[model samples]
Target: MKIYPIETGNFKLDGGAMFGVVPKSIWQKTNPADANNLIEMSMRSLLIEDGNRLTLIDTGLGNKQSDKFFGYYHLFGDKTLDSSLAKLGFCKDDITDVFLTHLHFDHCGGSIEFNKDKTAYQPAFKNAKFWSNKEHWLWATEPNAREKASFLKENIIPIKESGQLEFINLSEDNYIKNSELNFDILCVDGHTEKQMIPHLNYKGKTLVFMADLLPTIGHIPLPYVMSYDTRPLLTLNEKQSFLNLAADKNYFLFLEHDAHNEICTVKHTEKGVRLDKTYTFNEIFN
Candidate 1:
């Protein structure tokens, strides 16, 4: 099996929102912020190739939003879903599954695009089935006012309209559906409902999609949680438990937002699970 890092470009988010209760004085040193106090974050996605399955995890923010909306996030960079896939000698049409960690704009916005007629929305991966847990699907579709702004209808409704939306719930016996890949799902909340992070058994090593749960090595500290979390205390507990297991088991956590660092491991320091080392995805997989 082969996995490619799909970079959908970078966008700016308030450092405070990203770092949560962590003091700006500290987080700023690790993830330096701009004059606007916004940190540059990667809309990094992953493409998994196992047997005949080509699954793309979490489409990044697509270019369908209005310029005014784009003004807020300040999306910048030459990297995109198409270009990144091309770098791996593939294209969107080749994708057979889109495994969304959640439907947040930055994570799954690129799942759909505007039609040429400028009046309709269409699934970005025409041939791929869009994956989201049933509970999270309801949470996003019938979202609360607090999350409504982030859950745009255009990025979502089209997936259902395409007749490719599939829901994976706790009742599922096999997470991957196919026996081709030996990977499992680790579903968690606080960040969002039932966001599924992929855990893969690759070359005697376990690689996990850290999907906002750990986000970056900088977020290893439990209190370094993001303010965007629906439940900050719940996040603290989740991070504490996950990081401890990761440190003990020597698991590699893949960052979905860090602009520079891709994968990192944790170590049990006096202060608990702190950053141990950072490595590129290719370095680990190859």
Candidate 2:
């Protein structure tokens, strides 16, 4: 099995929101903010190539929003889904499965696109089945007031409309596994309802796709949870549990929103699970 990093683009988000109750003086050191106090973030996705199934984990922020709507996020960079796919000699139609970590705009927005007439929305991956867990599907569709803005209908409804939406039946341990795919699902509820993090067993290493659970290296500390998380206390416990397991298992964390660092590992330090080493995708995978 081969995994490719698909970089959709970069955008800026309020540093405070990304770092939760953590002080700017601390987080800014790792994810330095611009003059506007917004930190650069990458809408990074992963493409898993195994046999005939090309599963894509998390679609980045698509380009269907209005200029004013996008202006708020400060979208920048030349990398896009199409361009990145082209670089890999693939296209939207090549994707067989779109495994969404959750239905947040940035994580699933690219799953749909506007039709040629701009009058209808359609699934971006025409030949792909959109995968989302039942709990997250409901949480996003019937969003609470605090998370309503992030769960955009345009990013989600079309997948079901396309007759391609499927939910994973997680086991009692909140795990899902398919024989064809060389990975298992680790579902957690802190970030959102049942956000599924992929634990890929590739080349003798367990590479975890860190969706919003651990956005960047800056969030390695247990206290550094995101303010956008619906249950911050739950997130604290979730992160602690996941970090301890990751450190013990020596998992390679593939970061989603970290623009500077692509991947990192953790060590059981005196303080707790601390950042071990950072590397590009190719640095280790190649």
Candidate 3:
């Protein structure tokens, strides 16, 4: 199996929102904020080429939203989903599966796009089966007031409408081993309901896709939970358990939202789990 990093785009978000109640004095050290107090973030996705199946995890924010709609996020960057795939000698039609970690705008917005005439929305990857779990599908479709803004109908409804949506059944333990996508899925509910984190065995090492569960290296500490999380207490426990296991097993964390650090590993420090090191995607995979 071959893996590649797909950088879709970059944007800025309020650092306070990203780090939750964590003081700026602390988080700013790792994720420095701009003059406007927004921190830079990357919409990085992962592409896995195994046999004939090319699975893409998280589609990033697509370019279909109106300028006024995108003005809030402050999107910037030359990279895009199509351009990134082109660089890898591939295109939308080449993707067989789109595994969404969650249905947040930044994570799955690129899954759907405007049709040729811009008359209606359609699945962005014409040949790909959009992967989402029943629980998350329901949660996103019927979003609560707090998360309603993040779950845009334009980005999600088209997949189901296009008849390409598929649900991955969750096990009793919320873990799926050797899923049809050819990897283990670790399901957690703290970030959003049933966010699936993918675990892949690459080069004799376990690589985990750190979705919102651990957005950046700045969130390695036990208390650095995002304010957007509906259940912050649940997030604390989930992070503690996951980070401890990640440290003990030496998993290479593939960060999805960290703009500066592409990957990271944690270690058991006296102050609990802390960032051990960081690596660019090419540094380890190239």
The per-prediction tally of clashing pairs is: 0, 0, 0
**Candidate 3 per-residue C-alpha lDDT over 128-166 given as tens digits, one digit per residue, 9 for 90 to 100:** 999999999999999999999999999989899999999
Model 3 spans with C-alpha error above 4 angstroms: none
For candidate 2, the lDDT comes to 0.92
> Which candidate order results from sorting by lDDT in descending order?
3, 2, 1
Predicted model with the maximum lDDT: 3
TM-score, candidate 3, is 0.99
Question: Sorted on TM-score, highest at the top, how do the candidates line up?
Answer: 3, 2, 1
Distance from true position, residue 255, model 3, in Å? Answer: 0.6
**Candidate 1 vs candidate 2, TM-score winner:** 2
Query: Cα-based RMSD of the predictions, in order?
Result: 2.1, 1.1, 0.7
**Which wins on lDDT, candidate 1 or candidate 3?**
3
Q: Which residue pairs overlap in candidate 2's backbone?
A: none
lDDT comparison, 2 vs 3, better candidate:
3
Kindly provide the TM-score of model 2 when superposed on the true structure, using C-alpha atoms: 0.98
